[model samples]
Target chain A: MKKHNYSAGPCILPQEVFEKSAQAILNFNNSGLSILEISHRSKDFVAVMDEARALALELLGLEGKGYQALFLHGGASLEFLMIPYNLMKVEGKAAYLDTGTWANSAIKEAKHFGETVVVASSKAENYNHIPKGYVVPSDADYFHCTSNNTIFGTQMKEFPSLEIPMVCDMSSDIFSRTLDFSKFDLIYAGAQKNMGPAGTTLVVVKEEILGKSGRNIPNMLDYVQHIEKESMYNTPAVFPVYASLLTLQWLKNLGGIAAIEKVNEAKANLLYTEIDRNPLFKGAAVAEFRSNMNATFLLNDETHAPIFDKLWKEAGISGLPGHRSVGGYRASMYNALPLESVQVLVDVMKELESKI
Target chain B: MKKHNYSAGPCILPQEVFEKSAQAILNFNNSGLSILEISHRSKDFVAVMDEARALALELLGLEGKGYQALFLHGGASLEFLMIPYNLMKVEGKAAYLDTGTWANSAIKEAKHFGETVVVASSKAENYNHIPKGYVVPSDADYFHCTSNNTIFGTQMKEFPSLEIPMVCDMSSDIFSRTLDFSKFDLIYAGAQKNMGPAGTTLVVVKEEILGKSGRNIPNMLDYVQHIEKESMYNTPAVFPVYASLLTLQWLKNLGGIAAIEKVNEAKANLLYTEIDRNPLFKGAAVAEFRSNMNATFLLNDETHAPIFDKLWKEAGISGLPGHRSVGGYRASMYNALPLESVQVLVDVMKELESKI
Candidate 1:
């Protein structure tokens, strides 16, 4: 049976990416050598690295801009350390919004570098909604926020206009919706979500805002060093970058983020509509701040859990369970997840109501 | 034609690893889902992570010896930074042996942390030989060295006993030959060489050596944190780790390092013997320190370069060009490289001699 996979991350990618990447693994570009065995410096793999970096910038609509895209090895969690190591100055502060787990983790790492200020936090409410009306101090070296919270299924619909360089962790929602991508000085996402697989992180940084930290940075941690090397400052995650390029190419063929956003909206609406209409279910997050990429909801009565679980499992659904913090269900409909898969989950939800 | 790949790091892996990893990408474990799409936290992938970590220690013969193996990101270059952050105290110094490009790179990163002492260096000799008889300060935080220098084709044939933690960057020669695996307190290698691909790095550390640096280490750069998290401290490079696991399994099936070492010695002897006998060709690195993994050689008379290059290319040999600094040919016979490939290269060299 074809599974309706809704894994939050390392999640569903386009089927074509799987087939093509697998083929490359067997024999890359008809080179008679597996992609796994080829030197990253080979003309073939260098072309792959170049195209992947370019395609990522192109998909985000940042082409020809000062923003440079890098496919680095460590995931977004490493970016948490690099961001501070590259941006925060000696005794200088950085402002961060505590939205959820990832956002809070970023803050914890930043504190080790210098003064880290949490401008606002939705944590007190169990991160059920986006915190509003918070002030980001103008003196901050950078303002950081998580664009979407995967664990809580909450996303920031509006970003604050900040004088400082704005950095956002778009790990779960990048390339899902069309936004003013140029507004932020730095944006990063782990490839495991909407981009590709789990080996690389996509970092798009505005070159001008860097090298002002006035602190001596390690070569690997410095953005300038990576940018100068064209993301090949060291050995890159070649397979993941190639797979990400394939995903980005798939998105481009699907008319880019603009076209995909419409389908995503439809999927989110269908699941949220079912959640609201059925008395057996209720949405986990506040409606206004709910993430289109991941819809978190719960059964109104605990007793319906067994039937709902069985129905989804029998329906060939996988990865529909929510995070432990929000004990319910999370239907992650990433870029590659078909609308038909969302329909199947809704049907399962409705069937439970009828049986009751 | 099946080209014999001799590219250095990100070089050839076992053919079975390529096939199995490719299949996993399409559909993992008969689970009706791509390995690229499944959650790292999922039962299947977690098992992969567990087995990969266990297998690394098992292959190194470090199992049950207080060593914790971790698969990390950012390659050995990142370890250049992390080692200083985790092992070098704020006021203390560390000792390093500068052998070649990579060893010098390690020294540069360590200097950023604290006082870095070069115990020995062959840079003056263009790194054609490994430095020996260097004294390591007992008061230093740790003693660092590159076990094998890929760029210069030199390797440390012997290691000195140190009271301090002994850290070695075995990125190129790991698992290719058997050594006293318990000698080093920490061993790190980028998976691109003998292990797997370019995305993940394998770190094996003795538990007692960590957590004594006393610096406020960033969570990502801290080895103790990674060990505690069992290498899933963040989203690990899943594909690279899986592919590495496949390569390690292949090694074990072939009777592990003990069995592979005999083959490696045989392969090295075959090529080096030919280089010494052939009047037209001369070995680049010193015979005593020449690496078994990578053998650098040059044409004795530059006039025959085109013919020799053409001969190798015609024989379905690729990645035979030595690094620019060396200006010759480097036949990297990593573990996955078949002896037949080396025989082909030797035949080509003999063919050049006959043609000349």
Candidate 2:
């Protein structure tokens, strides 16, 4: 059966990128070696390195902006520690917007090193919306927020212009839209979601923001080490970085994030409109803070829960389950999720309505 | 033109495994979802988890030995910090046998948390051999050594008998042969060199090794946290781990370590004999300490180096350059390298002799 992938992370990718990536794994740009087996130091792979880093900057439109793009090992969870380690020298106090699990996780990791203030939390309303109107601690070194919450299906559609160094965890919605990345001092995303695969994390940091941390960070933990080595301080995950490059090229070929954003808005509106029009299902997140990436919803009756699941699975759609923290149904509409896949989910919802 | 892969780690795998890994990447096990897009928590992926872990233990022949095998995200470099964070709580010093660069790196990380003793070091002779006959520190908590030196092509043929824990950085040579694994409390290898790819690391730790260290490790950095979560602590490098599973399964189908060892030794012997017997080239390391996985050799005259490089490039043999540290030639004889390829390298050596 033909299938559509809606997994939140480690999710769907374009067929062109997969074919291109597989070829590289086999022959690596006609160099007659597997990308998996090649040294990141090799000339062929250096081109891959340069391409991956450049494409990230190109996609974000941050050339000549004093921002350095780094591809490093460890997921965003590791970055949770590193961001604090690299930036904590001036961070006597930091304001963290506790939007959901990932933001909370970041806040927890940061507090181990120094003082962190939770300015606003969405947990009171069950994280259905982005926490807003939090008093910005003007004295803090930087303010941190997650741009997109993968599980909760909430997003910070707009960021506060605090003017201080700003950090954003764009794990879910990076490359899904065009934005002024120059406004944020640092931004990172795990590759598993919108980027490429799960092995590497993409970090775009302003060079000046570094060297301010008073702590004696390990060479590996320091962003400057990777920056100096060009992310080749140690052997990198070459294949995943190559895959990221291919995906970025594809995104660029598809007219970059601006073009993708329009299509994304269409897909999200279709799904959201359908959910709002039907009584059998209800949007799990608050309307104003809804995520264009993830559409979380539930059935009118508990009896139809499994039925809805069976309906979608039979229709050749998968990975639409919601989080256990807020269990129901979650249709993750990440970048590269074809509009047809969302239509498939909407069709299932419509079919259930007819049966009722 | 035919090509051979000699780039270490993510190095090379059989063509069959690549084909299979690719199909799964497109859609996993007929589950109607790409392997990349599936949830690590889904039952479909849980089977991948069980198979890869079970195969790792089975390959080591450590069945029912009260040890748990884990597949994790970061490379062995992270383990340099993680190992001490997990096991260094005992105030007693740990013995480090410095074989090469990676070995010393681990030693540097261990010093941050507890007392460490450099029991042995081969750096005096330029890391030409694994150092031996150092007194095992009576107050030591554990003994750590790198199993195989990638750059120098030297390996520890045997481990010193000790009462304390035996920990190893087996990044370059795990599952190369059947070994007395019970001698070690923990062993970790990055997936690039001998495992599958560079995105994941394989760590096997004795279950009882935990809790002895009184240090507080960050949740992600702690081995116990991963063990408790069954290696599903977060979204894993899903495709790499899955690809590694196929490689591990491939290892088993080739009759486990014993069978592969016989073939691997044959490949290494052919290439080394050629390196020593031919006048056009000379071996880099001492014969007794040479690595079976990576064979380092040099041209008899430095003037012919570029010629030899061009000859191999035209012959479709790739990654033949030796490490800058050991400037000559290194023919990595990995498990996936066919005996025929080694013969090709020997043939080139013979041809070089005639040309010179």
Candidate 3:
């Protein structure tokens, strides 16, 4: 059976990345040693680290600048706390955009270290669109926002040009498109989406924003410690980093994010068009705020739900269920998720239409 | 040339474990799909999660017990801060032994939250041995100790029996030997040594010790939160956890930790005997408190150091350099390291001896 994967966070990965990373796992560069068995401080693995960091900088277009691209431990959830710990001073206030689950969680953690002001929030409308007209407080430390809402299926097409520095949680839609690097002071993403496996967290930070916050940050939770050590403070998740390296190489080979962005747009257009035009399916969010990465929708009737689920299962499709917070369907189209998979999903929708 | 990995952590893994994990990286279970491409919430991947947790409990002999084992996202480095955050209450103190770098760091983080007493310390002798306690503090919230010192190469042969609760940072030497679970209220280890890779931290905590800290613990850093969600509160390090699952399976097939302990003992004995008897090499730590996993030593003649390094590198042995604090050589003979590798190191020592 032809299988298509549509999971949200720990979604899909490219084939070449998997093949090469697997080979490295068994015998790294035919070095007669598994990649897992090598020391992180060794010259060979150091090269891997150097190249991965270099590529991340190149991809983000932050090279030759004072910014450091680091691969750190802990996922985006940990970053939810570390971001506030490193940025939010004791007496200062930080501006935040409360979009959905992850955004609100980051806000909650930020409240522990400093006062937080919701500059903008889509919560009033149940997070159906990217909330606009946020007033960035002049007295705030910085402004925080999530680039894409993974569960809510809303994206900020144009970032707010705030007077304060911008900090972004790009965990879901980091490498899917290109952006002006000069706008944001900091950006972070967990590796499960648009990167590689589920271990590493990539952080790209402008050096100027740190050390200003008057919080006594713990060493492990501090960004400056990782910045100084080049992210080798402790033993990192080597395999996941290596897998991410392979994924980056593949991305570069595909002509970088600009190239992939076109394909991604086409995929999103195909699926969203089918959902909007078809009677059996309706788009979940407002038309202006639909996510190019996650196309969410609801079936016309609940009676077709069971048969729809069975047909997809029979066809060997997986992770089509919506998040528990919202009971509908979400087809997550990460970078590694081939357009053919989206086509397969479009075909399923068409087939269902024919049956009716 | 065959490589012999003697890295203390992120060290040798079972050859089959590497192969199986590598296969999953490429085409998981021959599914024509990479494990990285799947959803962590999918049924197949959930089985991997459930089985890994199940096997962890089973391996620790805690399967149906009231205790719970969680796979945390950060390395054991995070536990340095998390331990204090989760345990230290207002007016409460935790007693800790200052043994080595990791132990001191744990103490450092603990002090930030509440009172911490360094009840015993081996710093007087430069961490050559674990400290012998004159007393365990009566009012301690918990007595914390590192089970093994990776840099100093010292293992605790026996833990102090205290009326107060006890927790251990068993980072380097977990699963390398048999542990009496009844004495511990909590145990945590980074999964880089004697397990799998270096992304996930395994935490086994007693339910009674939690919810008493009185600190506003962030959800990501909270052990209770992870326990409640079965470690799926966020997307975990899927590849590392999955790789670790295969390692536990390999351990079970080899008759669990007891069977591997014998092999580990034999390997350690062979290498330590070489260090003791050889005129060129001298053991640094006390013989009685030496670790079976990492045997730290130095050259009898400092002049012969360059030659010693060259010889070992020529022999394709890596990670033999001892820690800078204890400058010499450390041949870490982990559970997966074959006795044949130990013999090969012995042969190198003999060859060096003949030339000198």
lDDT of each: 0.93, 0.84, 0.86
Q: Over the stretch A1-356, how does candidate 1's per-residue lDDT look in tens digits?
A: 87999999989999999999999999889989898888888899899889888988888899988999999878999999999989998879999999999999999999999999999998889999999999999999999999999999999999998789999999999999999999999999999999999999999999999999988898999999999998999999999999999999999999999999999999999999999999999999999999999899999999889999999999999999999999899999899999999999999988998999
Q: Which prediction has more favorable DockQ, 2 or 3? A: 3
Q: Regarding lDDT, does 1 or 2 come out ahead?
A: 1
Residue runs of model 2 more than 4 Å from their true location after superposition = B90-92
> Best candidate per DockQ, number?
1
Per-residue lDDT tens digits for candidate 2, residues B25-70, read 6667877566766777788889988889988998998779978899
Using lDDT, rank the candidates from best to worst: 1, 3, 2
Consecutive 10-residue window with the lowest summed lDDT within model 2 chain A? A25-34
lDDT for each residue of candidate 1 in B1-356, tens digit (9 for 90 to 100): 87999898789889899999999999999999999999999999999999999999999999999999999999999999999899999898999999999989999999999999999989889999987788999999999999998988988889998789999999999998989989999999999999988899999999998888889999988998898898999999999999999999999999999999999999999999999999999999999999999999999999999999999999999999999989899999999999999999999999999999
Better of 1 and 3 by lDDT: 1
lDDT of 2 by residue, A98-158 (tens): 9999999999888877889899998888899997678888878788899998888988888
Could you tell me every candidate's TM-score relative to the true structure?
Answer: 0.99, 0.96, 0.97
Question: Model 3 off-target regions past 4 Å?
Answer: A310-316
lDDT tens digits, residue span B223-286, model 3: 8888889889888899899988888899999999888889989998899999989999898888
Q: Residue A218 in model 1: shift from native, Å?
A: 0.5
Compute the DockQ of candidate 2.
0.58
